[model samples]
Target chain A: MAMAAFRREGRRFAPLLHPNSITAPRSSLIPQELDPEGVRFISTQVVRNRMKSVKNIQKITKAMKMVAASKLRGVQTKAENSRGLWQPFTALLGDTPSIDVKKNVLVTISSDKGLCGGINSTSVKMSKAIHKLNSGPDKETKYVIVGEKAKAQLVRDSKKDIELNITDLQKIPLNYTQAIFLTLELVLVDKSSQAGLISVLADDILKNVEYDALRVVFNKFHSVVSFMPTMSTVLSPEVVEKEAEAGGRLEGLDSYEIEGGETKSEVLQNLTEFQFSSVLFNAVLENACSEMGARMSAMDSSSRNAGEMLDRLTLTYNRTRQASITTELIEIISGASALEG
Target chain B: MASNAAAVPFWRAAGMTYITYSNICANLVRNCLKEPYRSEAINREKVHFSVAKWVDGKPQKPRDEELWHGNHA
Candidate 1:
């Protein structure tokens, strides 16, 4: 036959092909069969190992959730207390008209730690969207990222625009001093003409933060389970003055005199600076609270998912064990019948 | 641009020395301090420097000596 002739010819021409033949011992292409008992044993070991690891992970996530929950209480109280100052001040500036500016500074507040679902990314996404809307030929938008995790994400989109990225802040609870120092640094970076000309503190820097309005984007904590990224704007005193002249909330301010013989402009400037820092502080605290809430929810879900996976794996393991036992019983019965025959 | 109404720098406006500003901020934080956070704010953490120079659009490590002395005299 033609097939026989082809095989003979192939063998004669390629004698080294014997190693790939079916009769060859331990050929790498062939899969060695596993006995039911062996299969069951391996599966049990694998499932046990997997279950143990998952249980450990579940424990870790549960602990983390509890920690975040406890921390949330303290952070929430701090944020609520500061609302007394921020609510009325922002109400006063509510009607201020937007100003046109060449440069705008956007401060995105987030936390360095992740494992919280979308907490950091929400701020980064909002920052990116705002930058996209505002970036133009005549306009330049600079970003001040508060968290390292967010900095890493936003850096990809706007490396140059990331004027400052503060990390290692999550180790401690955010305080007023941190907020003031951070605001001062932001003011310094936004200044185009000044470079080491002089050392400035809170007041001089506030003047230099010359945006028609300052915008802080952060995750606003809604409840123990919900948080959303929110944008809050702080209008400059200059803009507020203009708004006042145009019959805004401060229309009656001209009739009143500032205490201590301070000029109206002086008093307004101080108030504006105070409000700016206060707003920034509140945002930082709220973001901290949100981060904790997000972490708690995320870890809770993670723990639940792990539990589900463990259940499925255990069911599969039990089925595999039962199958192995059934196979052994059938083998024993067959052997006894063969002996009787 | 140089009007009498120009905004005075805070350090000049308040005539605050470096030590005074730190002391003031410390005292202010300590005044309204509550339990657990009180000790953390006052003892554990300290805000040493006021000004951080932004070099090439990044905050440089706040040079302690230069910040206090360079701004003073």
Candidate 2:
């Protein structure tokens, strides 16, 4: 009966002072080498410190989620509006498949930073798949990685295959070379700096470029929660002309007449170059949108988890404090009764 | 089957390569885009990363000279 009464009060049975192991992410916020005996000795103090760290993490996660949400709206709008730019190119050239090609240049587009989700992985996976499907006897392949993340992932196994890794392009175009930027503004859109950047990069690419066809791999944003890695193929003007004669996969361009004095080959060459830049523009915007979306959702979940952890820690803190107080009261009562006896 | 012979593009006549011409075209299209998106598009493309080309399985050193003293070559 005496044991049952102690158990009922949970004074001896209460393991509240014993810290329970938390989930991975939350535990990482607290120090790993927590001494159990020390924790019991300092009871509520340890829980207070842990709660403080979790509260800070929760604040950061909440802030990140908000930032991503705001950025997504702008990027998502641009991505939607830019689809018209590449649609006509796909219709004209016809998306070149991976099964057949002579020499291929794969432009793998990825974000410079990570922590979004599996977006960069998906892009790298698609690029590898394309590389695998296209590599065989009589076929040649090379890589033109755009962002740092893609380069890091691809450099592991296919370092030898990488021809160019273009990064920090924004600074190179506007401030680095005014001559080219002025030329682009004079000929094309004077205010569109993105075009100037593209042209400048293209100039750099042309210096060390030789490929029969080019394939662009990037993430295509579908919704706030869903994204897909997409690959679009573009053939060189020379190949298109050659295939046009043979009535091969690229026969669609023949139906359209070259209105300018420039010959069909010249016009085709210009069109292919324009198509590449336009597609690149769209690809970058879509990837940016997807990154923001992924980050928003990732941060959202993180904050939610932090909230749950805070609740649990608060409960443990209250229960431990109450148990200690009850034990103190029991001690005083026992002492008083012994003195009376 | 050609009706009217349009003049050759100015960029072509100026000895500019197809790469420049294409950039010009993309910029033109970018300008034609409706408001907000145009600015957003322009803003999104401006990404600054400290990186270099990977040639022969090796990374080219970033331009240390250019990054210092705000000097661009």
Candidate 3:
């Protein structure tokens, strides 16, 4: 019965017994010789340290996930609400001739923080591709960067190409006013300059400028987890005119009426300018929301992965502890038996 | 331990008051237990000590006791 009890105990502590009995070619072959107490101490220390580190990581990820989710909700709502308002405005301006202007402008947006994974890298890569497509020694592309990470990447990769870098927009209020200001500052200022400068100078700037068509590339948020790079053209006057004519026919419209003291030409010009600002604002808001959604999904996945790791490590700790106990019990019983004999 | 206590912010010090109170109670039980099993129980108790303190509404203190217990246990 005692032997059977010993056998049962051995079975219970099989992990501990099996390792000791696995014959090493020599004592030197054993990497480290540790007593049961030593093994228990080291294992406990390792498990405790690892668990603490994992818990800390999990806490940070959880906080980031919550922050991202809150931001995503706010940004998504704003983007959706503004989309309908901007669509009609864009359609109205489609009839004007594109300002036969030549200026290259690139706007890039990326996340401020890392750990949400490849969002920043993807944005940077897309920006580089856009730069390659648009700019050369013969033709220069001006840049307006949003987010610190994107600004840093652009400066590093294409320093000569960048004209302006704007970072930390999240700290400031993002609104239509800001978008209009950016558009005026980046695109309109030079284009609106000197109708009488060297006609060739004006023509050179205006000819290649294509100021009316604004091309913006950004990640479009499909869901919390997935974002795809999407490019949308904000029409110059000529394209807008075409779109408006198409739209006007669909609406069974003949002439767009302008109320008050302005001529049709003046009203059209004012409306078209407002339309350009609206498109820029809408695109920026949409891209911001998409970035937040992508971050939320990435952090949530990281938190879940940390939990799984903690669970596996916990199981290993328990098994190791049980093994240590069993081995200790065997050694005590064997020592007592030897003394009695 | 003194440096840690000194470094703790006022809010965290208030949290630590609750943590210390609960830990004292737990240590009373742990100190009274026998060896081997005593160490194991203490170790297990320590692992959960911070969580217990957090549950009781204390925040900002590192779960030192629980972590110590885990290593020793």
CA lDDT of every candidate: 0.65, 0.66, 0.54
Q: Write the per-residue lDDT of candidate 3 for residues B4-72, one digit (tens) a residue.
A: 334343422333222222344556677678898778665544221110011112222221111233222
The per-residue C-alpha lDDT of model 1 at residue A315 equals 78
Q: Would you list the rank order by DockQ, best first? A: 2, 1, 3
- Expressed as tens digits, the lDDT of each residue in A1-341 for candidate 1 is 23323333443433355533622343222122221222222235656677789899999999999999999999999887866767877666563324555677888888878898888888889888888877789897778777768877876657767665666665656666566556655543323223333344433333344465677899988887888788877766676677678775768767666666556665676566667777888888889999899999999999999999889878766765666566668779999999999
For model 3, residues A74-183, the per-residue Cα lDDT tens digits are 88877887777567853544332222224555566665555656777787787777667765556655555655677566666566555444444455335544554445
Candidate 3 overall lDDT versus native: 0.54
Error of 2 at A299 (Å): 0.5
lDDT of 2 by residue, A1-341 (tens): 23223433332223453333321233343332353432322246678998999999999989998988998897688788888988988777777675366889898888777778889899999999999988988888988887778889998999999876766443432221222322222123222333243433333322345677878889999998999899877777788788788885677777887674678877876777667666777777788888889998989999999999999999867775676676667879999999999
What lDDT score is found at residue B50 in candidate 2? 44
Per-candidate RMSD, Å: 8.9, 8.1, 23.9
Question: Which model scores highest in DockQ?
Answer: 2
If scored against the real structure, what TM-score would every candidate get?
A: 0.74, 0.74, 0.60
